[model samples]
Target chain A: MMAARRGRSAGLIRLALYGIGLVPAVVSFVLGATNRLGADPVNTFERTLGLWALRFLILSLCITPLRDLTGVNLVRYRRAVGLLAFWYALFHLSAYVALDQGFDLHTLLADVTTRPFIILGMVAFTILSALAATSNGWAIRRLGRRWKALHRWVYAAAICAAIHFILSFKVIRVETLLYGLVVAALLAFRVYRAAPRRAKAPPV
Target chain B: AVDLAAQPGPLSGEGLKPTPLRDVTHYNNFYEFGLEKTDPAERSGDFHPRPWTVRVEGMVAKPRTYDIDALLGRKLEERIYRMRCVEAWSMVIPWIGFALRDLLAEVEPLGSAKYVAFESVVRPSEMPGQGGVLPVLDWPYVEGLRLDEAMHPLTILAVGLYGQTLPNQNGAPVRLVVPWKYGFKGIKSIVRIRLTDRQPRTSWNVRAPDEYGFYANVNPAVDHPRWSQASERPIGAGGGFFGASRQLTLPFNGYGEQVAGLYAGMDLRRDF
Candidate 1:
């Protein structure tokens, strides 16, 4: 009976995550309609979605800590959250290229090559794509332990994203600094937690 | 866009279309308020602009504090000009104000005055950005122009926008409007006008001298170290939808006829 209840709760949680993930697009549309996105609505929409994408990525990373520290595992929804993050990032890139750059491939190519922050963003998204593609049960079963090891790239993706965010803005704001600190702490926590267990296992 | 049909031919010939009023007023980069575009519009409610006084000092014969009303009482003309930002965005604004030359005339600048410096008002309590959130930039924004740039007919100390008094976020009471240069060259909420022999240290130049220079003229040849300046994303061109409308940037922002002669002998690529 307890197992059945756990399964039901996990399904409900997944539904809730999907609902939450889709809220930003609705909010952006309403904002656009009411002329509330401020001057440069495209920029506002793009920035808002990009921020939401980062938040979701951070939240997805937080789930593992929540499980290990408090035994409140939300592991089943991680893939869904990760995929949402990827979709948001894709849309953010679309906004930049279509709305900001006006589909100028030359300009977009120039930006990706020349702008260090843009290159970092592109790298983070590329890593996320790899993780998302291999997230299925079939891929996991086929790859065996390799799947678990490769998924660790998320941490690298998170760090790259944090650095990109910091470098993109003109000023290193307090909020941006706080975000970088949080990413650092999260990575440090993962390392500290893993070292003792890896030492005990000692190559099997 | 400014209604060209409504205005006389002489005014129409000189005028470029002003960006949509909402876009022109709402989208801002006044870092004194905050970095976000909407921050100034939202956070400037508490800023007190009335009874504002501007102290004219330095190499001037008559250094005095001119009230907002006193400045408004003088003969003013409407100037419609292009404003380009250092961030590669451009806007055409119809600003209402008198030429800076008129203000300089009042002060009677001394022979030694080679540059004119403008200082913005600073109230940390009101200006959220100045509250030490990002101390990267020096507070009380400062910008300077050569004596000739200061005296140019196109250079105006603006007081209003779109036929109305400027909103606080739009630099209420007074601000500098130099059509030929990047937007940062135009300091907002000006409180002091000083004449000096040496070039004043502008806010952005002090923060990142390599990226921002003293005379930040709009030149397509010289790009910002971080981004391309050859083209600009004109805001409000999308017509309530998202449009990029990247247009080729003009030398001196298409005001070469009036201001290009000032830099005739100087290399624009280096000056930029």
Candidate 2:
């Protein structure tokens, strides 16, 4: 009975996470519709979407550390959090394409190829897309052990996204410092977690 | 509302509609206040724009200090200029000011004066960004222009916008407006105008020489190392979902006919 109750609660929390995840986009839409996004609404809209994507990506990274450091197990919701990040990233890219670039193929190609920051952003987005595609039960069963190996690329995607955020701004503000520091800390924890186990037993 | 509705001034903005007054006052890049677009308008309430004085010295004949009232005595002409920021956004502003050449004539610049250096005010108590812990930029922002560029007919010492006294967030009291250059070249809240023999140190160029240059004329061909300069979105152009579509940026910001001769044989790519 306790196990069943706990599972139901976890499922409810997962549903809550999805509901909360969409608030930023809904708020952005309402603000845009009401003309409350200040003077440059389109730029504001584009940047807000990108900012939320970063936030969700960082939140998804926190799940593993949360489980390990504390006894709280929220593993079931990790996929939901991660897919939220992917969807937000998709919206961000769509804003850049439809609003910022006006679907100008020439400019889009040039930006993706020549701009270092844009290149990094695209790299991160590509990884997220692959992860999201294989997140289903059927794909996980088909890929078997390789699924774990493939999903590890999220670390690379997170690093690229952090660097991309840093490079996109003209000046380094406090928010940039905070985001960079958080990502650095999370990645450091991963390294520290792996180093002790590796020292105990070397891989053949 | 009444101020913006005044009669058209001596110069026109080529029939381009002025950006809404709300956007003009609220959205700004005044780092003295903060980095956010709305920070300037929100945080500059404590700033006092009155009781100002500008000192004109260094390589000038008279080297006189003019009170703000004296500077305001000159006949103000409204010239609608399309202000393009280096960040790839723009606004059509109806600026009210007299020719900068008129102000320079009063100072009587010496033959040796090849450049004009401008210095902004320093008031950390009032301007919170100046007191920021990180010090993103050096205090008391500075800018410069070639002597000929300063004396160009299009350049002006703007004291007002939309027929009213300049707002604190929009470089109150006095500021420089060079239509051809990117908006950073148009320094704000100027407290000092120094004439020099060599090129003067500008704030942005001093911070990042590779990204910003002394002569920052707007050219679509020259891309900022991080982003393209080929196009810009005019603020308040289209009021809907996507806002305004990006319009191609023009050489000399479409003032090439008036200012291109200023850079005759010089290569813009190198100077930029």
The top-ranked prediction according to TM-score is: 2
Every model's TM-score: 0.89, 0.95
TM-score of chain B of 1: 0.93
| Top candidate (lDDT) | 2
Model 2 native-contact share: 0.41
Model 1's DockQ score: 0.38
* Candidate 2 residue lDDT tens string, B1-272: 11322345555558778899888999889999999989989999999888899999999998989898887776778889989999999999999887889889988999999999999999999999898867778878999999999998899988888888789999988999998899999899999999999999999998889999999999999989888899988887555565568899999998999999999999999999
Model 1, span B1-272: residue lDDT tens: 11111122132225366788888877888887888877888888888888799998999999988998887776666777788998888888878888889889988999999999899998989888788645867878999999999998788888887877778898887999998899999999999999999999899898888778888989887877667788887877654334446788998888788788898898766667
Which window of ten consecutive residues has the lowest lDDT sum in model 2 chain A? A195-204
Candidate 2 structure quality by residue, lDDT tens digits, A149-171? 99999999899998888887878
Highest DockQ against the true fold, candidate:
2
List residue ranges in candidate 1 displaced over 4 A.
Answer: A1-12, A29-36, A196-204, B1-15, B242-244, B265-267
With candidate 1 superimposed using the best TM-score fit, by how many Å does residue B230's alpha carbon deviate from the native? Answer: 3.1
The second chain of candidate 2 has a TM-score of 0.96
CA lDDT, every model vs. true structure: 0.82, 0.88
